[model samples]
Target chain A: MLRNISVEINGKRILDNVSFEPNRGINVILGPNGSGKTTLLRVIIGMVKKTEGKVSLKGKISYVPAEFFSAQMKVSDVMLAGSRIELNEYTKVMKKMEIQGLINRDFSTLSSGEKRLVLIVKSLVEGDVVLMDEPLGNLDLANRAKVLRILKEYDKTFIITSHEIEVLDFASKVLLLKNGKVLYSGNPADVNESLLSELYNVKLRRGKDGWSNFRFDF
Target chain B: MKGINLIFLSLLIISFFLSLVYGQVYVPFDKIFSLHGVYKTVILDIKFPTTLSTLLIGICLSISGAIMQLLLRNPLMDPYISGTASGGAFGAVLAYYLLAFNLPFSWIIYISPVIAFMFSLIATGLTVLIGRKTGVYGIIVGGVVISYIFSSLITVMITEMSIRFPQVPPLIFWLLGSIQIVGYTDVVILSLLALGLVLVSLRYSRKIDLVSISDEMAYSKRIDPNKFRVFWIALVSVIVGYVVSQVGIIGFIGIIVPHILRRFYGGNTKSLILGSITLGSTILLFSNLIADGSLGFEIPITAITSLIASPIIIYVLVRRNAQEY
Candidate 1:
């Protein structure tokens, strides 16, 4: 479990006085763009140092950044970095991800969806507290569903950030963030249309088939 | 293949013999085996040490270059490019002039390199620290600044030294670099230092690869990027410092060797390290042979490497540009 995280950037509070205890399930930081989602994730994994709180966690943690093109290394090479896994196991993981063809391909050469899959597989193979920044970004519906299935089956603590409602369907809880503050933090089933509409300042209309779209006045 | 290894071994042996033979006065091959006279003394005392030193220096510079490239994650990073060599050169020149260190020196030779190595480490440390706060462009810019600072200091020292000591001109030529005669002690010190560095480098090659990907990625893996970066910069400084003190400045081996090896071996640090050492030593040996053999007067080894490397570098740049177009 990772807990007690507060973060600030350039002396302005971002994750101001925020603390949470993450259990063994999917916890999604449901927030709009630029709502301190990435910053909270960064603080959790010790990438960005927290200002006033300490992060106490057991076991290792793997963080997948929103932008993963930080290295020019090959797919397999980056995944097997500093681990004791053999070559065949690495190949097996790649094959399972259907990214076997991209094993030798440079990280810079992969498509956005393919890179996302690689990062997901990397986090899964390590089997730890996986913190991902928008893991579903740029992924098609099929790939997104495939990744969500994998995350559900892994049975580890998953902290993910995404704006897609379909991606958040499997999330046990959605922490609705607005203006860097958590307005609603509870079961996704309890988050109704009125609360979400007020949080995002948009009229969220629910349709007959359980699909909803937000209508915003510019 | 084992055959290739054997071939490299044979070439190394042949180069060693040829290096001993082709010096100021050519010792006849037939009389090379004789047990008596100046030929034996020259071979045992002078040529042997020079050849060994050349081999060790080549290995050191090349491995250092490979490490620097991986550490900086910059394709263009070299000892000269990062200003380590220039810093060492300044230290040597300072030792020659300011300290009035005499020729055919003993502990002073080691002392000069140690000083230069420390200075280069500090310079590179500062670069990495600033670059971490800023970015890659910042490191490159900082490298340029450090290089200019060391270059001007070298120039000032050279001018001042020339006025005080007439033999300082030859010392300046040494700073330009050559395959001049060195004692066995020099060869041994350099070989030991290079061996130690290579061992440490091999151990940290994986961490180096992590850093190459992204500092943040490395941090996520529980490896402190700052500590690893500082370690690598210090390692490169020591290797560069030792070479510059022993043999002045030999360029391009560090830069070109790693680049060429990368073409064949990909970016796996283990393979890259091995390939750089072998290829670097071969190139240095071949360049030294050309410097010693082709012309009546021995040219500086740096000139030979530059002459060979410039055209190839231009060719690569042109090919890349053409592809872009």
Candidate 2:
């Protein structure tokens, strides 16, 4: 939960007066690039110092960075980092993620999507509250769906930031942010085309699957 | 022990005995322990301390090197990369200068390591302060700059000394690194100190692993990255200062042993430090064997290590870059 969270770095405000109470499900933060989405996540986990704010989260928190600089360690070693899980528990988690065979492989040699999944599994096993930054960034369509499915059934607090609007379909609560200000904080279904259009600075239409950027006017 | 570690240990044992037997006077294996007079003096008094000091220094530098890499978050980093060796060398050279010219602080020659230790801390502290704002690359650049400045100053002082006292041999040979001149008292003291530092470092291995990932990761794990960085860096400076004060800057052993063994031993700090103990000593003992007038004259130990390490470092760099593509 965040209240009056504002972050200013080098005399430039990165996050203005922002606030939201996230529930025990996927609370998706929708925003354009540099709209302070990542900064908001970092502030919550105390990675970026909030200029002024009240951040209160009840539970252990783990973070999956947007770009994981994989250490020259094994996948299993990376997974068990800062976690009290046993090898069998790690194996079970890895099995669920379909990365059991990669337990012995060098983490650096894994593909980007595999690495992202590994970190996700790591965060999931390590914390009751997981803050993921662009977790679906490097994942392919199938892996994205796989990850989203796993997250939806995990029964924990997930504060995920994504530029991809498709995740909007699964979000229990949505916080629409534009230029560091929260424009909407309610049900995901309440997020409309016009507000999203304003948020991205372009005219958009909601298609059967998700929102799409169209240039028919041009 | 693992395969690599066992191999290294065996190599160390072999090299240890060989060094004892093949010094200035070839006291064969039979005479090394049982003989009296010159053979006993050479093996027990002269060669034992020299070889023991060399082994101890290797362990200290190698562990320090691995810790330096973790603290800096740069695999290429070594104990000397932060200017400690050059700073310690500067202090040693200054001590010699003062003694040679009967300067005000001429008595410092008796307790030169204290001066060297102080200078080493100052140099590394300056590097840390200069680079604190800019992160990894800044610290590396700052270290290089500090190292160069101290090295230049040492060269100037040595040059002046050479001009004034041409009959005395130059300190350049020692600066290049040699274990041939260490006495029993220094060896015993260094062994105890190095042993304590190594044990302390091993205890922090798990924390070092977490910190090496990233500061945010370290913070998430409830470990303060900045605090650990300072503690480890200070510890490494002490290790380097002691080694340099006793035997000058050995060079490359710190970088080379860790860089090489990390392949066979893996990147876990505990295992790497453990493996480094054996392998680092093995490499140095062999180098000392070749440098200890075995081929009729002495060679600086750094020369041998540089000859071995430079190519391996280049190969690793090239291979890493190639892998990235």
Candidate 3:
């Protein structure tokens, strides 16, 4: 239960007067670029100190950073790190993520999508209260769907930040952040396309398939 | 597993005997059977104790370097980099200048190392306390600052003491490190200390491995980085304190020996600890031999090692820079 966190960086307020109560499901944070998404994740994991508010949480909190591949290590080595899961469990997770082939490869040698899958699996093997920063980025559609399926099956509290509209489908609650402030907090289905388009000042044209034009408006 | 361990054990024995044999005056193997009175005394009293001290110092310093590098997660790190050697030097110099009561020879020899060890440990404690707020960089900076302060004090003490004592030149030679014969009692004590350190290091091998990955990763594993770091800093201080007390400031073995072994053995602590002990002992023995035997001059053991290690350090820097760009 991570809550009541406020963080500021370089004299700029990144998370301003924010309070969150997370239940046992995926809570997705949807925001545009520079919306304090990564900063909030860092604060939650106690990586970056909170300047103005307290971040209180119980149990283990595992964070999968966006640049996980920046470390020079073997893929299997990184997966085994900080995770108490058995080797068989790790291998099972790798197979489920469709990355069993990457087990022996160097992490730096893996493709971006493959590295993202490995990082996600590593975090999953750790204890509950998983906080991921853009877990689906650089992943292809198939791998993204595989990860979403795993997230749905796992019984743990998850707070994830992503800009992809497809990821919001898995969110039990979507917190809309604008300019480092919470603009809307409710169920994902309640966030109408027009409101999301209006929040970023972009035109939302509804097509037969879905809403398009993801580029933020000026 | 047994076979590998046996090989190292045999190598240690051979190296010990070779270290005793290869010195300024070669003691012939046949002379052991002849048993000349003075020859037996020279071999037993002088060369044997010196050989044992070299082995102990080598094992202690190398293990200290390996553990410090793992804790800091920086390849270039060593025990001396954190000001332990300078602090020890300061204590030794202070005792010489302030407490020149013309005590017994045994008192001067034994008490100096203990005083030096205590001073280095205090400096280590202070560094860890002040650096807690600033993180890793703070520790590095604090170490450098403390090193400078202690080094200045040593210089002042040396200048004042030299006027009164005519044997101050030999003391300076001792400061630069020499593998001259130590007493049998000192050898036994140093060996016991080294054995204790190796056991403690093995117990914490897993934690050391986790630290090498990254600090945040260690914390996520429920190992508080600060607490573990403090423990490691103390362990390293004791190792450095003991070795520097025995052999003054033998540079490069602590830094280069571990890295060179890491190239063959991976970064795992189990292999690293073992390899460092073997390789470090061999290098020290060889260096001491060159300083005393073939060189035919009273060359400082530290000078010989620096001559070998400086080029390797430069090569590592250039290679790292090339990789970075």
Candidate 4:
């Protein structure tokens, strides 16, 4: 729970006057580039300090950053880090995420997409409220679908910030953020074309498949 | 892994026994346990303490090096990389001058190590502060800078001291690194520090593995990366400080031992700390034996270690660069 949360890094305000309560299901943060989406996720996970306001968070929080860092280590050790969590539980998540086979290999040698999947598996086992920053950014279409399916299936709460609006239908609630402010927050169905167009400052058309097509409004 | 552990144990035992033979009078292996007269006093009082201190310093410094590497996520990190060696030496030397010029009290010399330990922590804190803004390479740079400053100050002090005590050993003796038996106190202190370091390092090994990946990941998983980094860095500093106060400064053992283990054994947390201890004890024991050989006079341990470790450090760095490409 973020109440009037604000952050100033080096001087410039990254997030300002933003308050939100993430839904128990998938909560998608829809915004364009530099909309403070990543900063918002970082703040929630206590990675980025908030200069002003209070954030009361409950339960364990695990995070998977958009840009995965590769350490010179084996994949299995990466998954087993920092927690007394059982190896069996981590392996179960790894298998489900289709990354169990990469366990013996060096993490630095894995492809970017593979690295993201490993981080996802790590977050799943470690967090009650998982915060993912663009978890699906570089993934292929098949992997994207598989991850969305996993998010849909997992009963726990998740807050994800992504530019990919095609999967918006899978998310129960949507928070359209722009210029570090919350423009709209409610059920995903309530987010219409007009709101997205204003949020992205481009003409957006609602297509028949529940996907909105973005076009230059100018 | 089991086989490797067994081999290391055998090497450690062999070196420990062999080290007893070369110091001053040659106590044959058969008479080692059979103590009666001068042989008993030499073996028990003199040789035993020296060899035990050597083994303890190896265990402490090597594990310290391994922990620094894991915490910093740099394979090149060593116990000295935090400036503890130079800073502590400077502090000890400062204590020496204070005693000679001002106090001249016999007990004042005992305070030397305590002052050295304080300086070691200060050096690590400074490095960590610089590292926060700069990253791993920055930490290295910061540590090197701090080391040079301390080294120059120590050199100046040594020159001044040598002018007064003309009959004393060249100040280089303190700088070159040597292991001498001070008393049972050295043995007891080294053993306690070594044991404490090993146990704490093992307990935090898993979290360290995660922290090595990224601070963000560690934080979200309920581990404070900053706190752990400082904790481990301070631990390494204290271990290095304790050893430097006792044995002057034995370089390369910290850096060389960990890399050797990481290559032959691998860097899983358990293997890293454990392998460093066993192999570290063996290597230092061997080096000590060579330093105090059957030769006419004693040679400094660093003279032998630096010659061997210099090439290994270059090889590890070059191989790492190759892997990166």
Candidate 1 local lDDT, A1-218, one digit each (tens)? 33445677887778766666666778888777777888888776666788877677676777777874334467777776655557676677667767788888876456778877887777777646888878889998788777787778777888888877654467776777776677778777777778867776776754444432434444
TM-score of candidate 2 to 2 decimals: 0.90
Tens-place lDDT digits, model 1, residues B1-325: 4565566567777777777677666777777777468888877787777778788888888888777777776655677767788777777666665446445544566467778787677666666666667665567677767777877787777776677676553544544687766457787787788789778877877777767766556777788777777777777888788777667778778877776765565666776777756677777887888787545677878888888777766765575455335
lDDT of 3 by residue, B196-232 (tens): 8888877766666656665545655667766787777
User: Whose lDDT is higher: candidate 1's or candidate 3's?
Assistant: 1
lDDT of 4 by residue, A67-147 (tens): 644666677878887878888898898888787898878786788899899889988888889889899988999899889
Runs of candidate 4 with Cα error greater than 4 angstroms are A67-69, A190-218, B23-25, B166-170, B294-297, B323-325
Provide fnat values for all models in the order shown. Answer: 0.28, 0.22, 0.11, 0.65
Q: Each candidate's chain A: what TM-score?
A: 0.87, 0.94, 0.88, 0.93
lDDT of 4 by residue, B91-143 (tens): 77777776566575565458777778788878878876887789757888998
Q: Candidate 1 falls in which docking quality class?
A: acceptable
Which parts of model 2 are misplaced by more than 4 Å? A209-218, B95-111, B125-145, B162-169, B181-183
Tens digits of per-residue lDDT for model 3, A1-218: 43455677778888876666666778888888988777777766556688766667666777666653233346666666545467678789888877788887755456778877877887787758888888889988777778888999999888888877766667887788788787787777777767788666676544444433244334
Which candidate achieves the best lDDT against the true structure?
A: 4
TM-score, each model? 0.87, 0.90, 0.80, 0.91
| Candidate lDDT values, in order | 0.72, 0.79, 0.71, 0.80
Tens-digit per-residue lDDT, B1-325, candidate 2: 3676678889999988888888666778888768698877777778888888878888888888888776776666675667888898787666666556665453654556777877888888888787777765678788888988988887787787888755433666536777864358768777887778778877777677767665665666667788888788777776687678667778778788887776775676777788777888888888888887888888887888889888876886686677568
Interface RMSD of 2: 2.1
Choose 1 or 4, whichever is better by TM-score. 4
Candidate 3, superposed: residue stretches over 4 Å from native: A6-17, A23-25, A30-60, A65-88, A95-120, A133-153, A161-166, A176-182, A192-213, B1-14, B30-36, B101-111, B118-153, B166-175
